[model samples]
Structure formats: structure tokens, C-alpha cells
Target: MKKQVLSYWLKDSQKKTYPRLEKNLNVDILIVGGGITGILCAYQLAKQNKYRIALVEKNRLYHSTTGFTTGKVTVQHDDIYHQLIKNKGETIARAYYQANSEAVQGLKKIVEEENIDCDWVDTKAILYAFSEEEAKRLQREQNAYDTLGIPYEWLDKETLPFQTLGGLAIPDQGVFHIVRFLDGILNNLNVDIYEKTKIIKTNPTEKGAVAETADHYKISAKHIVLATHYPIYKRFNFYFTKIKPTCSYVAIAHEFAIKPENAYINLIDPVLSIRFLDSADPKLMVAGFGHDVKNYYSYLDQIHKLKAMATERLGAKDFTEEWYNQDYESMDMVPLIGKITDAPLYLATGFRKWGITSAFVASLIIKDLIEGINNQYAYLYDPNRNKNTFKTVCYNFAMLSTVIKTKLLTVPKSIKINPGNGRIIQHKGSKIGLYIDQNGKTYSVKPICTHLGCTLRFNNVTKTYECPCHGSRFNYDGTSLDGPAVRNLTQL
Candidate 1:
């Protein structure tokens, strides 16, 4: 079985090691999560030359979402302006445009200012609508964009090479090398960065806060930024409630190599996003099959289907990489960036698959909050904003129900004995998943998620065992499907 999704960057690259935190240290500010959000936080704060910032990453810096991104670096997401305009009005939609536009400009400024050659390019980003209803939505989005003073053009059918009804093209959009962008920022920072460091526990102190790492170091700071794609601290913010994450499958292939002048994503269900890698061969990154991480085989099977689609539709001769990624879709269709409470605890999450653009805005908002400079967009994205719309309430309740059930349930004995064919069987007042493999072998595991320890449910449609808790899942053979849970199931 394939262990890791093949990443093109991992090839022909020298391995580099980073240091771990070994001493108790105090800093003016502390940033957690070394992905795009954390690194950008450090970059913004360091620019001020005021506070002493310390950034910590549990794993390799930039190897998280930032490294794994399709790397569009554009402002156009899947027809989102329509919903933003419908719910909050054009003003908020414009605010979204303003924030993302500023982020795009910020990236451009960094590329020019730092003289970093990360294959950064100025391109047009297009969102194609496959159906008439979606096309109407696209028009509404165009209107919203116009109302927001965003520069864009509409292309009808026969205007593009691909077969589609119409598309909305945002000019001066972009694609770039994420690694180079991160490396440039990290290379010049005076901030203290720790890699291979996992923060096991965190608590607030009389003055600031203390982050206790696995290595036994208590690092304190006046403020904290939970940049970990999923925040480690669990009690207060109720992050698991406000957001539902989906795991997406991605593939990089060599055939049909045309790095489009832009990037594209279908504005309908079963979202398919396509972008090109700039290299000698110029491979294509085709991403689709987004489902909750708890539906392991569902996503994996969907990935397999996507690979087949690439071969059949897009003419992908061979694939170099196949990996899975997680994105937290927000309840309000916008990012959550601001103080979690009245305290110095700050959060940046719920980017809804638009972390690259949103993370830049988050860095701006977070730096301003830390510097005491009042930012206008801060209130819009406040982590504590409590709107009880039916949709938001339902989403939260679903997550709560999943968490409770995951913790309280037990697997059945039928599943324990046979474990046949990825099906659920009753065992002593519990429902357990049973799997019998192709070799006529039977195995039993605690049919519970390792992440939050949720009981597992068999998904017949996806042919995998799912955890309703925090969305970790497994295959029939007791292998891990996705995270919040980093480990696979335990065999009995």
C-alpha cells in the first residue's frame, strides 16, 4: 500500500533537520502551527521590529498545508461571492474581496521585495459553471464582484478551450512556488522557530500563557496564535463545533501537460480543482473527491475514481503523487480570525479550502490584534461571533452528536469474532466493524477512533469503517484513512 501521497518536491531534494526546544524561554509573542498561517504570523510580527516572536511547529516547517497546497495563491474561490452577497450583502462580499485582494498584493510585494524566485506568476483565475443554475450563480457572483469594485471579465461558451457554459475570469490572479515563498520569509526572521515539537498541554498564567511541549519545556508568551491546522487546545473555543472538515484527494500526473495560463475549479458539487505545476515536464494537479475524513474508504475510493477520471478524461498517462489533505469549512462561509475570548488567546481557522488567501488576511488581522492596531475586518471574523442561523445550529449539533456518540458507544462481539467484509455486527450491546480480507483472513480491532476515541461505524457505500468523532476513519485491514487521528486502528 502507498504510505504517503507522492509529492513532487520530495524528489531530488536534500533532507534538512531542524532543532527542538530544550529550554524554558519567554517571548513577547508566540505563534503555533508552522504552516502558511503560523509562518505568515511570524513574518508580519517580525516586520514591526517591536516584539520578540517565537514560532513552534510540531513537524517540519512549511511541510504541512503550505507545502501540500495546489499553490494557486489566487483570490477567486468556488463561486463563494454569491453566497456572501446573498447572506450578508454586497458590503461583506466586498470586504472578502478587499481582504483577499490585499493578500494577493501582499504576496506580490513579498516576491518583488525579497527577490525570491519561487516561479511566481501573474495569471487569470477562472471559475467554470457547468449547469445553467450554476451559471446564474456565476452571474450573481460577477455582480457581487462588480459591486465590490473587483476587476473581472465574463467569458461565454466558445470563448475558452474547454467545454463549459461560461466562466468568470479574475485578472491578475496568480500561482507560485509555496516552498520558496516560505523559505524566503523564514530565512530572514529573527524569530525563534522550533520543529519536531508537539505541544501536549497549554494553560493561561497570571501574566501571559504557558505552552508545555512534549520535550518538557514551558514556553510563555503574552499572546498565542493556534495555527495548527487543527488547534491542539480543546476546551474553550469549541472549534470542533463551528467547523466541519473534509479530506480531499490529489494527484499529480505527467500526461496532458499544459500549465494553463490560470487555474480552475468547478462551481458545483463534487468540486474539481485543476492547476499546473511549473517544471521541466509541467505536471498537472487534479484534485477532487472531498468528503469527511471519517469516511476513509469513501475518500480513498473517490481518489481512485479521480485517478481513473484523469486517465480517461484528462489523459493522465502516469501519476507521480497521490495524497490526501484536510480543510475546515466554516459555518459562516468566512474565516474565523480574532480572539477566542476576551483573553489573549487568538485563533485563525475555518478557511474553507481557501487558506492560502485567507491565511494572508489572517496574518494581517492577527498582527494588528497583537500590535493593538484596530483592524476593520477583525469584528467580521471574530471567533466568538455567535450567530444562531438554522444552518449553523444544525452543523454544530451534528458535530456534538458525533462527538458524544463516538465516546460513549461500544463495538459488538459479532464484529469482534469475525470482522467480516467491512460490515458492522452486534457484539454484547455494541455495534462493531468486522472485516474479512481477500485472503480469507479475519481480524478484529477496537472499532473506535484513535483521535478522540470515538466508536467506529461501517460505511457500506465507502467500504470503510468511519469514526463519527472528529472524523478519523480506517480501511478493512485496520489501516488509517485520515486524521485528526494520526495512527491506524489497533488489531485484536
Candidate 2:
């Protein structure tokens, strides 16, 4: 099987590189991530013309989760209304819907005003159920819509290529080429951007905060925003424990048999999402089958399952591209966006696999907070709020079990690892990560994660070592792929 390639949105886009920071610089605001959250935040702040802004990215902009997404921009997040209303209240649930809906509308206005061609489509979003239990849950979600006065349609069956017990359809929801939209905003904004500039540390001074890059260049800013998908600092927020990172798979197929009119996701376990790249063509995108990163024994199995589902269930043929996305799910189900406990540092993360709309919403809240303007949705997404301690406790327990299991487990010495594959083996009283390419060349590295020292697992599909503790990933050659880990693994 062929390895994953770039997403359809990024295939034809021109790559724009920015200079790295050569010396220490001072700015009004310094953003540490170049994803949608950081880009939008910089745009909103730059439009006001009040502060000097600088944004830094570890890699190229939009090459992370923002570009790897399924490109669905909607408020219908898999029968979420029912759960929100039950957990928080009708008032907060309505606010959550309003926040995301307004984000969609805001994006539409931006695309129109800026004259961007990101294939923006005002399509419907549908959530289907495969079993009676899921159908009942969807019915409760419909009731939530009623409570919130939101318009929706309940369907027993539709024109979908697959069978479903029932479904929920919400109109005026949409999808767009997120990379194009972000690129347009970046082009129009006057913010200083630096790519391939990884930040290693950020500490608060008396007046502000200082961010130090891996190259030892410093950026002093009055305010700092950690828009990195996973916050680098774990001590202040304990985000490593509270936020659960999951690995999800996606595949794009050409010559698909059925064209979907709207974005579709199911309400059952191992959720499957479907949508078309173009309403006029047979190009289709299917994504889902998420699991906690630590629980995955073989990444290839997940990719194979997604491809099988696309071909067998959705009649997809000749997959053109496939990729994986990692996202952190907040314990409370609401995104954490706001000040990090009265410090100058701010954060936007834990979007629960719904970062597109949440990123926009976070930008708005962060902008308002920095400008001393009151936002109505601020309290709902407060990072310091500990209303869901039960979930946090349960998550900590589960994490401890995984950590202990990784430290104590042993692999049989007789088991032979295959060529072009990786395995963790006990060697000389320590665990060693070993990978052999198809040509029979050996590549070895220390298997421990550089982030929090969690044991790393071998991902056969990506040919990388993944951390179960905090989702840090490393290449076979010990180079860092994702973080929470600023340093690469130590070569054995």
C-alpha cells in the first residue's frame, strides 16, 4: 500500500515560506502556533491596528490538523446538543450552538468581503443513526433543538447510499477549503509570520512574557497565545491530564459511485463521516474510527479499516489520498479557551475534533479578552474552570494504567519483527525502538517519549513512534513530528 499524501485542499496550493527569527524581538502579542486559531486571532488583532503582532509556527502554516480535516464547517457535532443540554443546561447549550453558527456566518461574510475562492458551500449537515439506541439518542437531540428554538428536520430514511434507522438534518451549515480561507486571511493581514520556528519555552516577566525558540532567539510580548493544538506547558494547566488526544483516520477516493449532497456523520460508535469534494463530481471524503492514541497497537489497521469502509459501504474506488489527524478532546466536551489562570499566557485547545468553528470562536474570545472587551461566551470556555473534576479523575486513572502497563510490559524475545516495520524490544536492560526498511537497513532510537518520558509505541503505518502520555510523535530517525515535545528523541 502507498503511504499518505497531502490533502486535496493543499495539493494545488502554493507553499509560502517565511523567514526565521534571527534575533530577539519585542511585540505587543506573540502567537505560538500558525493554525486557524492563531491566524484568525492575528487577523482580528491586526484589523484593529492597535498592536504589533508576530506569529511563529513549528512547521508550515496549515500543514497540521487544520489542513488534514474533513473540511466540514457546521454546528451539528454528532448529536451534541442532547449531551450539552444534559450536562450544562439549555442556556449554555444554546450559547454553544449560537457560537458555532455565528462562526459559520462570520466565515461566510469574510469569504464574501475578501473575495476568496475556497469552494464555500452552504450545504446541510446530517447525523444518522445505525441502531435503535442511537436513533433514540438522536430523537433526544431533536428535542434539544426544540428547546433551543433551532430549526432541524428529523428523517426516518433518506437517499443515502447506506441504511440508517433515522437521521437529523440541520440547514445553513457549510464546508470550505480551510487552507484557502486561511491563506487569504494571512495574505490580507499585516502580521509578521515565521515558519519552522519551534518555541521551546515561555516564561512570564514582570511586565510581560518571553518566548524562547529552539535556536535561542527570544520574543518578548505583552501577551502570549498558545494556539498549538496541544499546549506545551503542562504544569500550569495540567492539560496533559485533562485533555485526551485521539488519533483519527481519513481517506479521499476518486471515481466514487455515490455523490453526497450534504456532510454526513453517524451517531454510533466508531463513527463514520462522509462528504463530497464537489456536488457535481464523484470525489468523496470519508473519515472517522477514532481511538485514544495510547490504545492503538497498529496504525495500519485503522487506515485499512477506513479504506475498507469507504469501498465496501460507500462504493468508493481508487483512493487518491489518505491521512491521519490527531485532536484533543476536552474532558467537559466544551473547548478550553481563555486566560491561563490570570497569567499573561493564553491558550486555545481541546476542541473535541471540532476545531474549525471552535477555532473561530476561540479567536473571538481571545481578542475580546486582550482588548478588555466583555464577551458573553467567555465563561463557557474558561480554561481554569473545574466543573468536571469527575471526568478529570477518571482520565487520570486511565492514563496511569496505560503508563504503568507500558513500563512493565514485556515482549517475547522469540517474536520476529517483519521487514519494513517497527517494534519495541528489550535490550541491555532498557527498551530500544527498532525499525527496518524494505531494503533491510536498520534504524534504531530510544523508545521513550521526549515530552513526559512516556513509553513510545511503534506506529507501522506512519513509521513513527507515538506517545501515549501526551501524543508527542517522533520519526524513525528520532526527529520530532508533533509536540508537547520540543526536543527529538535521543538516538540509541
TM-scores for every candidate against the unseen true structure: 0.84, 0.94
Cα lDDT listed for each candidate: 0.75, 0.84
Model 1, which residues run further than 4 Å from truth? 1-4, 10-14, 257-259, 294-297, 400-447, 450-452, 456-468, 472-492
**Cα displacement (Å) at residue 74, model 2:** 0.3
Off by over 4 Å in 2: 1-5, 158-161, 411-421, 435-443
Give lDDT: candidate 2, residue 250.
87
lDDT per residue for candidate 2 within 1-492, as digits (tens), equals 354555777774557789987889899999989988899889888989989999999878878778888889999988888899899998999999999999889888888999988888888898888778888888898899999998888776765557778688899988887888888887788999998898988888888889999899999999999999888764464678778888788888875666567889987666789888865565788898888887844656787888887787777778878888799988888999998875788899989889989999999999999998999999999988874599898988888888887787685443477788888888877889998889888888998887778888887767888888878888887888775787888987
Q: How many Å off is the CA of 480 in candidate 2?
A: 2.8
RMSD after Cα superposition, model 1: 4.9
